[model samples]
Structures are given as C-alpha cells and as structure tokens.
Target: MKNIAIMGGTFNPIHIGHLIAAQCTSDHHLFDEIWFMPSGNPPHKEDEVIIDSAHRMEMCRLATKDHPTFRISDYELNRKGKVYSVDTFAMLQKEFPDNKYWLIIGTDSLFNLEEWYNHKKLLKIGAFVIVHRSGYDEEKSLEQQARLRECYNTSFMNVHMPQIEVSSTIIRQRVAEGKPINYYVPDAVSDYIHKHNLYQLGDDHEIR
Candidate 1:
C-alpha cells in the first residue's frame, strides 16, 4: 500500500519552518509522498485577517517545487466554504482508496485534536504524525498522546526537527513594517510577495 502524508495548514505565506518540518517528516522514510494542503478558509483563524487563497497556494507551490517527494494540493482551496479536516480526509480516501494516509500535524495541535470538528471520526480516518517544535512541553505531548490512544485508539508518531523560530504571522508583521524577511521564506516566495505587495497596510484585496 502507498503511504501518503497530508500536511494541511493555512500557509498564509509558506515559510522555511514549514518546509523544514515537512522535510524532516519525510526523512523518517514512512511516507512515499507528502502533500501540502492549504486551506481556503480556516475556521479557527476567522478572527484574524487572511490573505487570498491563491497567493497562499502559489507560495506553497514555490516552496515545495524543488522537493521530489513534496507536492501541493488545492483540495481545500477549490472547495467553496469552510473546509474541515474530516471532510478533506474523507475526500482523499474516496479518491485514493488503496493508499494509506497519515495526517501530519504539530505537537501543539495534537493537544487540541479533541476540540476539532468531527474529531472522533478524524482520528479513525488516518494515523497522525506529530512534528515536535522547540519549547513545547514533552510531558504534555506524552499525556495527550496516551489519552488519545486510550480513548480513540488513534495512532501517533513523533518527529524531531530543528526548531525554526519563525512563523507566518511574524513574517506578515515584518512585511507590513517594511522589514526584510530574507532567509525566513524561499527566494521565489519572497519575490512574489514583494512583486504583489502582499500584507502591506491598506492592501486588503482578495483574489477573484
């Protein structure tokens, strides 16, 4: 069976941190491919200002272009409204019935899995690979993993990667303040953002 991993995120602006995590996860030799799925509209981040999905998807594509095992998926982006994890997983399973999938998520998100929409069903859909970040509490992760295993019989794998201290939120803030984001994101992505003037003050426009 083909082992595929899904790395779904807002990817407001794909950064080096995201790439590092995906690469490290792939290094484990468990997955044959890793698909980066950028959400169209993230339900949890509704309060925060999000750029156009097209821009986000382009950034992801540029970031993963050089990696043979990495690919970008617009599954959620093509969907009209709020796209839930369970729905995405179900669609993928239907499309690729013969492949086994693993949902790649951060250690931070693993603790909040129970709060996600259709959480129980999502757990049973596929195994979860937790990517460890710096400064995260190891004990808390263990506790949550044990709890999920006992309650839902969910499978979890932990991957240790070099902690990248940058985030898309920070990158956006820097761009708005006219600060350089060099080395934080791929060169192609940075050029695209600059050429398009994304995240600049008063430039709130959606891609149609």
Candidate 2:
C-alpha cells in the first residue's frame, strides 16, 4: 500500500510555512505523496469568510508546483455542507482501500483533536504525523502526543521542522497594509494574490 500524507486546511492563502511543514513531514516519513486538500466549508471557519475555492486551489497548485511529490486535491472543495477532516479521511479510506493514509496536523490542532467532529473515528482512520507550529510549547506537544497514544492506542510521530513565523493572517494583514509578501509565500502565489487581489481588506472581501 502506498503511504500518503493528507494535509487538510482552508489555506486562505497558501504560505511558505505550510509548504515547509509538509516538506519536513515528507522528508522525515518518506511519504509517497503529500496531498494538500483545501477544505471547502470548514465548520470552524463557518463564521469566517473564506476565499473562493478556485483561487485557493489555484494558489495551492502554484505554491507546490516545484515539488514532485506534492499534489492538490479538490475532494473537500467539491463536498457540500460544512467540511470536516474526519469525514474526508473516512471517505478517502473507502475510495483508496489499498493505500495507507496519514493525517498531518499541526501542534495547535493536535491539542484540539477532541473538538473535531467524530475525532476518534478520524484517529482510527490511520496514523497521524504531528508537525510543530510556531509559538506552541514543544514540551506540551510531546505530552499531548503521549496522552493521545495512550488514550487511542495509535501511532503518532513528530517531525523536526524549522519554525516559520509567517502565517496566512500575517500575509493578509501585510497585503492590506500595502506591504510586500515576497518571502511570506511562493512568488507565484504572491503574484496570483496581487493579480486576483485576494486576502486584502482583512479577509472580509473574497475574490469571486
């Protein structure tokens, strides 16, 4: 069975930090491929305005174009209602029964696993690879991993990743302030954002 890593997110704007974390995980675990699955309508972001799926998906494509093992999936984008990773993973497992799936989540989300819809079943879908997110306590993350392992009887591995302080929110704020996002995101992504005028005006306005 091919080992695949699923990186699910809203990706309001694909940034360097997202790529780095996925790269680090891919290198550490030798995943066959890393699928950047953009959530269409995340339950958590229901109250927040999300950019058009076409733009987000295109931005993801531009951001990971250089990586041969990286791919973008529209599975969640085509789904109806509020999107949840648990349902995504479950469907993926059924569709690709021969493949071993690994869910990639940041340390921040690691702590909030229980808050997810049917999180336990999601955990049962496959192994989880936890990557470090900037500004989170490493010790606490390790402790949480241990707790999860004991509670769920599943394998949870951590990847050693270089911390990037940049985030989608930061990039959006910078663009709103007419600042450069040169290093914050891939050049293609930066140009695309500028061309499409995305993430400006504090994410309150989404490009159609």
Scored by lDDT, model 1 comes in at 0.87
Candidate 1 lDDT over 1-208, as tens digits, reads 7888888888988899888889999999988899999888878887677888888989999899989999899888899878898888788889989988888889888988888999999887758989988889988898889888988888888998887889988998889888999999999999999999888877364221
Where does model 1 exceed 4 Å of error? Answer: 203-208
Clashing pairs in 1: none
**lDDT leader:** 1
Cα RMSD to native, each candidate?
2.4, 2.4
Error of 1 at 46 (Å): 0.6
lDDT of 2 at 152: 78
| Alpha-carbon local distance difference test for all models | 0.87, 0.84
Instruction: Give one digit per residue, the lDDT tens place, for model 2 in 104-170.
Output: 8888778888788887877666578889766789899989878877887767888867878887778
